[model samples]
Every structure is written in structure tokens, then in C-alpha cells.
Target: MSSGHTAVTTALQPCGLPEHRNCGIREVLDRIGDKWSVLVIAELSPGTRRFREIQRGIHGISQRMLTLTLRRLERDGLVLRTAFPTVPVTVTYQLTDRGRSLTHLVQQLADWSLANMAAVAESRRRWDAANPESMIV
Candidate 1:
């Protein structure tokens, strides 16, 4: 909700103030707002991939979290899940058209984080070095 992109569109103006304010965008933002969801969707962009494949591709994502996030994505129509009619029944997740559209924005944010992390780290280091009061003396 903090981001301006979550605001309702001009097409919703006919709905009046209250109804427009509560437009469906809130749910969409809430779903994609988490970093894990962005990464998960991005990983699925290359092609349909199994649960384990996605988990392995994105480091530090726990199995439980991956399951929950994927379910949410599927529920939101951002991802499609298919269970193969095999002896073992394999399942795969892939981005829907809507989810694919988010790739550039999500990828840009990731790139920006990678590019700026060093400067941000340096700023934090400087602040910590200057503020000795907060540290254990």
C-alpha cells in the first residue's frame, strides 16, 4: 500500500471513492510485496520448474516458505500449477501471463539491490562507527 503503484486506476473512478479505494490491487500488491514471491516468480520465468528446482535455484528459501508462497501465487492467478499424470505424479509451477509481466519490474529491483548494496553497507558502517553509544562498550 505504501507504493504508489498500489493506487486504484482511473478506470475505477466510476466506483466512487470508498469502493475505488478498496480495489483489487491491494491483494495483488500484498501477494507480490514479499521478496521471496518476486524471486520465486522470476525463477519460474525461464520455464515450468518443479518445486525442488525452484527451491534449489533460490538460496535461503525454506521448503515451507516455498510451498506457501507458491500456493499464494497460484491462488492469485500469477502462477499455474500442473500435476503430471505419471506414475509418481510430478508437479510443476510456471508463471501465468500476468506473472510474466512482472519479471522486468522484479528483475530491475533485484539488480538495483545488487548494485546499491555496497554503498548502503558503507553508509550503515559509517553510522555504526560514529554512534558508539549503541554498541557494547
Candidate 2:
């Protein structure tokens, strides 16, 4: 492997265990790397937002899915959920300090994806043309 690859692998596996056994990174990634979580995080990044606002901001996300996403993010300590006593109830969500720290990384990834989207699409088109039988969908 390249020295840079080795360095990254070593850094990620600081516990000296196999990559599969490294639950920290895997678990966290499994949470934040999900399709909805990043969007939810980015939605909450600007400031606090109500449930309906978040739902409105992210297209195609059902109410149930948004509820579940917020619950998971809250459970993971990446989001802070506040409830206010009102006629019904007012709930707001914002990123915790840890979540804010992750926002930078997420934003960087988002920027990178936007910057390389055309290149990636072209690459995929070429690959798909060359390997039509290998295409899943």
C-alpha cells in the first residue's frame, strides 16, 4: 500500500485492532454517513429549526423519517433537541458542539462532491458504457 494510505489506515485504527473491530469510526460513520443524517445536520447547521421547518427544507423526507432521524441524531449526541410547553408543543433542534465540529468536515465533503460532480458523472458514464453487464440498475 502507499505510505499515505498506510498512514491514514493507521490513524483510523489507533486501537491497533483490525478495521472491522474498530467500532468507534464504524459506528459513528454508520450514523452520520447515512443519506438523511448529513442533510439533517446541514439543515440544522444554520441554527435551530423546528420539526416542520426541517421537514420542509429536506425534500422527499417523510415526517416519520424526519422524526427517526432527529431521534437518532439526538441519541448520538450530535444534536440537541429542546422542547417548549405550548398549546401543543414546540420542539427545536440544533447541533451540539461535537456536531458543530463535524459540520466543518461535512461541509468540506459537500463542497468536494459539488466540485467533482461532473467529473464523477463522466467517469461513471464511461465505466457503465464499458461494463454494461456489471451495472446493477
Candidate 3:
């Protein structure tokens, strides 16, 4: 309330319009939009796998990141985690029905990425070549 300042508000757009409300698809994408999430789903698409197996299947992922990603997926009901009593206790992660359904969509995205990665790379190269100043060291 100082310096003659006043709060301003604007009317929100209609819910049916994407600009106004949070879209359901956007919410779902937010849940799994990370690169690691897609890769993790791909690794688990075949069948149930233990934590170590999943980690080994997807290279370049740190243990902490993997744990966090799995926890998020589990919380979203897209993955099921089972732990077995053993000397050190063993745990496995498997896709739930919902998760399996999502695999197909993620696979399509993977296919698209594979098919178009070269084109995307070429576009980036052209852009960088045209605007050298934009390139970061």
C-alpha cells in the first residue's frame, strides 16, 4: 500500500480455451515430459525389471535421478513397485495397466524422435552457422 501502488487484476479466459485453463493433456505431459521418464518407460515396456536391471538398461542416468523418476511414475499410478524380503531386500518396477497404455504413446514419440533427429540436428546446425553469435561455448 506504499508509493501509491495499486494491485491490478485481469479476467481469466474461458476454461474451454487452452490459454485460460490447465489442459488435461498438459497435466499428463507435465508428469512424464522429462527425457528420463520416456527412457525409463521404454526400458520397462518389455516386462517387469528390478531396480538394478532398469538402471543398467538405461545408460547415463544417475541413481538419484532414476529413483526420483520412478517415484514420480509410481505416484501417478503409471508404475507399480514391489519389494521382496531377502538378505538385502530386492525391489522391482513394472508398468501398471495405465502405464502399459502410455508405453504405446511414448513409443510413437521415440519413433518420431529417431526419424527426425537428423533433421532437427541439421536445422540447429544451420541456425548456428547463420548466427554464430548465438552459439554458446
Candidate 4:
């Protein structure tokens, strides 16, 4: 390792976990890394939303997929799912304090993606042009 690049140790910090103790981090990422979770989270960030409202906010998400995503978020304690007693059951989803805390993080990620997308696209284009054999159909 270079003198300037210190070797990273297992210190319980995220993005740096001990090999055997990575399950916790992995599980957390599994919850957040999935495409739908962040979108659903963003949709709920503004306020509580009905199932259809969240579905409409996120384009191309199937009803089954949205239900599953909401279930997972609720299970993780990031989202609160409330079922109202109406003639037809009305369900709403909202961010818990934990989920609310993630708003800034998600927004920052969105900002980063926006800022670097062009550079990333160019890099990918260059890589594909240079390494044609490695490209997959």
C-alpha cells in the first residue's frame, strides 16, 4: 500500500466491515439498494400517500411490486403502513422518523447521480469502445 493510502481496518463503519461481520451491512444495503425502495421512499418523503398515489408517483412500477416494496420497508421499520377502516379498506404509507432521516441521504444520492451521469456515461462509452470483446448482448 502507498504511504498516503492507509490500509483499512474493520471498524464497524459502513463501506468498511470485517469480512465475517458483513451481514449487517449487507442486509441494510439489500433494503436500500433495490431500485423500488428509494423511489417509494422518495414518494413518501413529502407526506403520507395512498397506495395508488405512491404507485402513480413512481412510473412503471407494478402494483404487486409496490406492495412488496412497501411491505419490506414496513418490515424494516422505515415506513409506517396504516390501514383505515372504511367501506373499502384504505391503506396509506408514510415515512417513520427513521425513514424521514433517510430523505437527505437519498436526495444527496440523487444529486450525485445527476452530477456524474454524463461523466459515467462517457466512461462507459469509452470502456465499451475499447473493450468490445468484454461487452455482453
In the range 17-126, model 4's lDDT, one tens digit per residue, is: 55556457778889988889999988999999999999999999999999999999999999999999998998888999999999999999889999999999999899
Candidate 2 wrong stretches, greater than 4 Å:
1-23
lDDT of each: 0.88, 0.89, 0.89, 0.90
What TM-score do all the candidates reach, one by one?
Answer: 0.77, 0.84, 0.81, 0.82
Error of 1 at 121 (Å): 1.1
Runs with alpha carbons beyond 4 Å of true place in candidate 1: 1-21, 131-137
**Candidate 2 lDDT tens digits, 1-137:** 77665444345344447655656776778899998999999999999999999999999999999999999999999999999999788889999998898889889989999999999999999989999899454
What are the per-residue Cα lDDT tens digits for candidate 3 across 1-137? 68798675875444568575765766677778888888899999999999889999999999999999999999999899999999799899999999999898998998999999999999989888989988453
Q: What are the clashing pairs of model 2?
A: none
Candidate 1 Cα lDDT to native = 0.88
The numbered model that scores best in lDDT is: 4
| TM-score, cand. 1 vs. native | 0.77
Which should have the higher TM-score, number 1 or number 4?
4
Ranking by TM-score: 2, 4, 3, 1
Better of 1 and 2 by TM-score: 2
lDDT of 2: 0.89
Q: After best superposition, candidate 4 residue 36: deviation in angstroms?
A: 1.1
User: How well is each residue in 1-137 modelled by candidate 1, as lDDT tens digits?
Assistant: 56656755664343336757767666777789888898898899898999999999999999999999999999989999999999899998999999999999988988999999999999888888989677633
Q: Point out where model 4 deviates above 4 Å.
A: 1-23
The alpha-carbon deviation from the true structure for residue 102 of candidate 4, after best TM-score superposition, in angstroms, is 0.7
Q: Itemize residue pairs with steric clashes in candidate 3.
A: none
Assess the local accuracy of residue 16 in candidate 4 as a C-alpha lDDT between 0 and 100.
Answer: 51
* lDDT score of residue 10 within candidate 4: 67
